[model samples]
Target: MYRYDEFDRDFVSARVAQFRDQVERRLSGDISEDAFKPLRLMNGVYLQLHAYMLRVAIPYGTLSSKQMRMLAHIARKYDRGYGHFTTRQNIQYNWPKLGDIPDILEDLAGVEMHAIQTSGNCIRNVTADHFAGAAADEVADPRPYAEILRQWSSLHPEFSFLPRKFKIAVTAAENDRAAIQVHDIGLQLKKNDEGQIGFAVWIGGGQGRTPMIAKKIKDFLPEADLLSYVTAIMRVYNLHGRRDNKYKARIKILVHETGTEELAAQIEAEWAHLRDGELRLPDADVARITDYFAAPDLPARAEGWAELAAWKKADSGFASWVTQNVRPHRHPDYGMVTISLKPIGGIPGDASDAQMDAVADLAEQYSADEIRVTHEQNLVLPHVALADLEPLYRALQAEGLATANSGLVTDIIACPGLDYCALANARSIPVAQEISERFGDQARQEEIGDLKIKISGCINACGHHHVGHIGILGVEKKGAELYQITLGGSADENTSIGEIVGRGFEPEKVTDAIETIVSTYLSGRSGTDEAFIDYYRRVGAAPFKEALYGDKAEAA
Candidate 1:
């Protein structure tokens, strides 16, 4: 993780002091709610149904042990006993008193963290692959680039207060774990013909009332011009992005209206002015940032196949965990373990203070003193030895962080629906819990194979429902909470938005409808060789739609 510098330190302290005064003003009645709204949002404080919620930025979802322990302290001292890790890979405290927010900010600053750009219509936290540095197939570490982007966008005078919230994601791996295609700006790091590292840049992608896969603006931007390239893209959007209507304010809308070719042309023109300007990255700067991300020291090769396979066979529970929870690390004998937050019916991304503390401890003891948060809202010990699996699992199980359902159907991704955000039509977490209970059996979940079931409370697509193999969006029909199901959607190298099956289902009917769809896939799919997404793409949504609604149940 990049340590905060003096300038960064001072900026946060000043911002904290500023926000403290604003909170005082809001509380003391010097300003009306409307007057204080933007100020609070900029600080990541949301006035929710029952209390104020504060979301703290964990840039690129990287954390030092000291930082994780600090978050645990904050959770224990302030709000509820827990914090919710989000799909965006940030953490949120559900209830923080208005007055205590300043103190909380100060506490976060103590560990070199803050809530700046966590919210508001500015560029938000830049999420990257959880297994970033450690992923075996990665061409390069993406976080240094993500950090560069953070510096470039943070309080940036030009791009701040854009059409709507801007999100950018980067991934070095070809697997697309970061869902880069669904972000406002998605950069996939790649090696060009000359073998110099650059980016396959995609812009204007987003998931909201309108979902769009980012169109490629540049096939290969040179390594030196990364910042300038990004600036050019943002500049183009800021100048022409819709601000006349909130619904159509995102860069996605602009991409739709202007067409990608014209948008690319505009970005190129903008790049002409800035590509090699002062904002252009020098090799030395890249080297400096890259220095922060040097790989953890790994021991010489030792293949422990018998020991690992024994652990796998002796403990099928741990085997299931290894199957889903563990991912290959670049180091031959090391692996990354995902601590699933979706434990049965609980909130998807939430972790108690004690759990956070334990995770930090485990990271320090069994692995390097580093932790990572995933876009799927899970935690990762990025460099755990294969030999350390049993002990780590035991420790994680002790902390209630061992769920073992990393990418299964029940491991659903849900937004902070109507319960927290006033914008949502229905509550997404409860819906996720209900679905989890509906398919609670371990055997049943294993039977279903790898499936991504995501839910967003509203059309804003906060939960990324549009990309789930089986996507569920909770909507308002007259006054009731109903669900619209979309099938065959994906956010991978070949990204595509889901197709809606038919009429929406009431909350009660949703679980069964999903079961029906899954059952249809199981029965009709070409053997167990087919994943849900592969089957959907091969046969299309018509078969699933017929199963979900039947012939008579088809239309709205």
Candidate 2:
């Protein structure tokens, strides 16, 4: 919730004016399609298969109720009646007219938001843990550092046009909810032995055609040296990262080609020259940023504990919702409520304008007037009082937002595959919808336990299929859609890339294949206590492969 200053307002206003002129030129035929490509991309506009797509940045995934209202307004006025929330915690409007983009940008600027760096080969939106300020186990809120990075990297001349797009994620919790290990640069905030906060820096982690977990380049870097160290890493990558081939242009590729030791040495050498320089952050500056993210005051609500127990006893539906969508907060009297966008058989991450508006109203009335967009494509009210749970649940239910499936099989994550994305090889939404309907039963989902099923239309890994417990990739073969399955992949603290189980399945067979995998896991697991990921790791891919492909598992 960092408020924009005069400088920010002026900068955004100026950019809007510039883009407005560019858009006008394109519409008037002064600029051709090829000429307008990079300009449009820089402003977060994409010419998709059907129409123009506009991606708006929600930095660190924090939004005020007022801003949420504006998002709903955009959906209602500019494009379709709904928008897609992405894995990066941003939102996409799939069918906006080309001429109206500048107006959309202006509208966003009014709320201190923009689409800059949401696309292009630059440092994209700096993301952090959605529950940063509210998590019980956080050493410090990572959003302050993320904001600092945003201020530093916006329109940075040196790193603006890198070899390929760059992403950075930060997290202060041990649970790794932000999937930091899969980012180009990942920062884990931790306290040292002396009780000083710093970061464990990881670089070269990404998930495209070549998925690699980041390597820890520094065990613990002083908080003051964050910018200097990060700049050093950027400098190294900018100088030596692949440029001739877009396929291998990411920093992860460079890390693979150049040994970690040598790369770390080079970064350290570069840091030695810049560590004590102007880039070093002062304590006063850090304090100023941290003040902007101070936790909201919460009066005691001890009576809610007793009241909540009574309510749960009275209503099983309410009880189920509480059990699934509610997470423990730093405050004992408070809870984090996840509003699942993936309703059974509905499109994952697509929220109608009315639903968005309803969430905004609920956040204003029950929560602390703040909303968080999770990397899992869900909205979170991070500081809801336990006493307010029932009313909030009822309001969300009325809007069809209270689908008690936070981490279940029905809470699937998918990209805007062939339906919207031109780069996609096949459709992703129908597959997600099919799988969601198959496991829509609450009892059956509970039986399966916590599972993540991520699907991507292509190898771009937009849906983060590489890290799901049951990852599905849709590929085109012989001019037909084929879905590939990968098992045991996870995006938690112990991150691991999923392995392909066998040959790709036809679109019609993909759901059945997923059902078979789940059945195999249920039968093979030692007990219900053993999660799908744990069981898969324990036994490896042999059993699931055998179950999916039968005697031909070895060949598969």
Candidate 3:
């Protein structure tokens, strides 16, 4: 919810003008593609398989109704009729014309949104928990710190072009919904016994060909030293991180090679020089940013729970949808509403222009004119009153946004794979659609429980396949597409990378394989009380592996 000031507006406007000129130069043949590639990438433009893709950042996943409406406008006027919400809490226009991207950037700028740092080897968007301000269990709002970090890192002279792309996530909730453990720098906002807010810092966590859970570089980092500490860490990584090989250039790889102890020492040594310097955040600046994210006013008791309960009792579908999509908010009379982008047999996170418009309207009417884009590839109306739940649900249902599958099996997270991404090996969206359709039954999905299935086209792990309870990685084998399945991966506070269960399956067999795994889990689970993740942890991957390979092994 942070608004742009004069300086911020001028910065973005200048960058837009610069990029506009660069684009024109490229189009006019004044510069070749090789010369224009970095410039376009710096502006969040990418030449995809068929056309160009434009990624727009939703900082800390916060947006206003005005911003959402602007995004819908871009989807309608510029690119295809729909846009894809990515795992990073960003939106991607998969079919934008190279010539029209400047216009798109200008449109975004009008709404205080931009494409800068959404791509290329720099500190990308600073993400936080979607439930940051509204979650009942949050320690504090993490957005203020995230915004501070965003401002500090944005176009920083020293760290502008790192060896590889970097990501940072902050979460104040006891539950790590932000998946901080798997980011380049994961900050878990915490309070000490003295009630002072600080962060438990984790470094080097990432998922790609080489997946890692970040190490705790600092058990507790004071709030005041945030920028300084982050700077120190970046300096260490920038200097020591590999540039010779793109594959091993990430901070995760550097951490692995240098060892956590040496890395921590280096960071600490660097911090000694930078601590209490110009980067040390002042209390006044922090307060100003915090004021921008102040919680909305809500009545202590809104008269709607009784009627809502009655409605739920009368309508099973409504009850189911509420149970799945409605999350507990800090305010008792309000609920956080998750708008599912994953409709059955459709792309996982694609929202049409009309859907976007409807969601924007709903956010303005029911919520406090604010919206949140979740890392799970969903949109959230974070502060809806209980009285407004029925109307909001009705509105969302009419818009095709009410899928009633948040955290369910059908609520899949998949990247734009072979269909759009040039780096992809196989089609991910189709696989996600097939899986969603396979488990599309409401009864079956509920029976399956809170199962997370993440699909990535390649090892880059854009879909967060490494942390999914059931992770699917599509790979190219010979001339055919093979899907590899990993079990027991989780992205929560207790983060763990999944293990491959067996040999890869052909694309056609993937759904069946997933079904077999689920079936095996249901049969072998301690009881219905035991969740898939708990059961998988207790029983290990043996049962699932046996279920998958039993017949094949015998035949061999």
Winning model by lDDT: 2
All candidates: TM-score: 0.98, 0.99, 0.99
The whole-model lDDT of each prediction reads 0.89, 0.95, 0.93
Model 2 per-residue lDDT tens digits across residues 1-556 = 6999898999899999999999999999999999999998999999999999999999999999999989999999998899999999999999999989999999999999999999999999999899989999999999999999999999999999999999999999889999999999999999999999999999999998999999998989999999999999999999999999999999999999998999999999999999999999999999998999989988889988998999999988899899999999999999999999999999999999999999999988877889999999999999998999998888888999989999999999999999999999999999999999999999899999999999999999999999999999999999999999999899989999999998999999999999999999999999999999999999999999899999899999
The per-residue C-alpha lDDT of model 1 at residue 47 equals 83
Ranking by TM-score: 2, 3, 1
- Evaluated against the true structure, the overall lDDT of model 1 is 0.89
TM-score of 2: 0.99
Model 3, range 296-340, lDDT digits (tens) per residue?
887765688897899899888899999999999999888999999
Off by over 4 Å in 3: 551-556
Q: Please name the candidate that would achieve the greatest TM-score relative to the true structure.
A: 2
How far out, in Å, is residue 325 in model 2? 0.8
Residue-by-residue lDDT tens digits, candidate 1, 78-108: 9889999998889999888899999999999
Which 10-residue window of candidate 2 scores lowest in summed lDDT?
361-370
